[model samples]
Target: MNQSATRLNTEELNLALNLLRAGELVGIPTETVYGLAADASQPEAVAKIFAAKGRPADHPVIVHIAGVEQLAAWAQNIPDEAYLLAQHFWPGPLTLILERQAHVSDAVTGGQNTVGLRAPAHPITQQLLQHFGGGLAAPSANQFGHVSPTTAAHVRGEFSEEVLQLVLDGGACDVGVESTIVSLVGDKPKLLRPGGVSREAIEAVLGDSLEHHTNQYTAKQRVSGLLDSHYAPRTTLITGQAARLQECIAEKLAQNQKVVLICQEINTKLDIEQFLMPSSPQAYAQQIYATLRQLDLQRFDTLFLALPPNTTEWLAIHDRLARAAHHRY
Candidate 1:
């Protein structure tokens, strides 16, 4: 592992801060995934993130802060639910969408009245935010619509040093997926995106059922990771149940196409290359992106991932896989 991979080095932290102050992009680690970060107050700095990733100007990014105390600087008319969710899930993988304050840049909110905010639990990034004392508008540290980076090495591979100079290596992400996004701007809190935080858990805290609004393209307010074909890999990805995926694998192999499979079980021996994934949802989320990146690098004709159980616990995983897949078998 690199010296800064899992630990915060003072020199590296300072360099990242300096880069952000100078309106440059920095790859900052978060508990969810690595993020391409810039000072949120600087629209020009934030624009570089979109330019480098080829992200759409209309698609909004999340602004990361140190803790709940800084929330008021970016959002106005904050609801009690926002505070409640932040109290319970801040410094973790929950992103709250609220109405933007007047000073909040349109670049951060994608020309909308709403802005997404998260307080990441990564230690190195926490330190960076604390020292910088400002919000960093960051999206996943990878090309737009690609699998997000879960490690510093992955971030480095995504962009040239000129584009993204310093990647503060905080090692592999704990919650390999992005943050759970809940839009509090509406009369009812809507679950905009299923992610690291479970919907059930968030509902339990709110004491009301959340309105399911994942993948709502018609929504006037945009949030991160809500697109139809996001988090995809370069290689063609086909996902389905184990039996169905196996059938597809055989069909592809028969056509003389190279195929790989990642699943929870193996009932029979087949000629296809295979990798076993964790059966548990938490473990699965942590490894899914890295596994996809690994398989994507092998140049396979197709990548087959057996779908896990369709349950509340696996909702986030299913949502991500659905968007990542090129086709469903």
Candidate 2:
């Protein structure tokens, strides 16, 4: 994997702080996913993040802070709901969207009026943010619209050494998906994206149901993972209706295609390898990305997946797979 030798000690943190302070991007680990972080205050450095990831300029990035106190500095009209949720979920996988502060650069918000902010739970990243004492605009440390990295080695595999010089090695991510994004820009709070935090949990805290983004950006754009087509791999992916999975596999085999089944249903009559995943929400969320990346590494010709039950817990997994199977969408 050619993992960077840079440790997460005082020396490494000092080096990362200097690189970021000088307007350069460094790979930082969070419980959700590894992020390519740059100084949010430096527009040029933030722009470099877009260039490196080949991310669209209009797609917003999350500004990670050291703690809850920095929230007001970047977002405006702070709502009690944000604090309530952050109090319970900060230092975990939750991102709140609020009206962008006037001084905050539109570049960080992808020219949108709102910004996403979070206080990640990883100690290494928390330490880095504390020492830096500034907001860092970071997204998944990988190519735009690709499978996100869950480990330090995965980040190294995503970019060349010259491109990502120092990846803060913090082992595998605990929550393998992005943060749950709840936007408080309008009259009500909306769920732009779901991650480690389940909607039921968030709603329980807010005492109100959240709105859903319909992806109707006909006139304007604002989101991180709402693209109709994203998080795809070079290998083809086929999402089949749960009941009709066998039919889908049969059709694929009939066509002489190599099939890799990534679901619970196992039909021994079928002559293909199957990888079973945990039905439990927490376990599935932690392993989904690493599973996809492993399949991509195996150079599989096709992946046949059955949909998990359409429950609140499986929301984020469904969203990611739907994007991975962008062709069907």
Best by TM-score: 1
lDDT comparing candidate 1 with the true structure: 0.90
- Model 2 earns a TM-score of 0.94
lDDT string for model 2 (124-201, tens) is 888898888989999999999888998988899989978878889887888888888888777788888888898889
Error of 2 at 166 (Å): 0.5
Task: Report the Cα RMSD per candidate.
Answer: 1.7, 2.9
Give the per-residue lDDT of model 1 (tens digit) for 1-329: 22245546778877888899999999988888899999999999999999999999989999999999999998999999999999999989999999999999989989999899999988888888999999999899999999999998999999999898888878888889999999998789999898999999999999999888766565556788888899999999999888777677777888999888888876467767788989899999999999999999998989888898999999999999999999997
Whole-model lDDT per candidate: 0.90, 0.84
Error of 1 at 183 (Å): 0.4
Pairs clashing in candidate 1?
5-171
Listed in order, each prediction's TM-score against the native is 0.97, 0.94
In model 2, the worst 10-residue window by lDDT is 1-10
Q: Once superposed on the true structure, which residue ranges of model 1 sit more than 4 Å away at CA? A: 1-7
Give lDDT: candidate 2, residue 263: 78
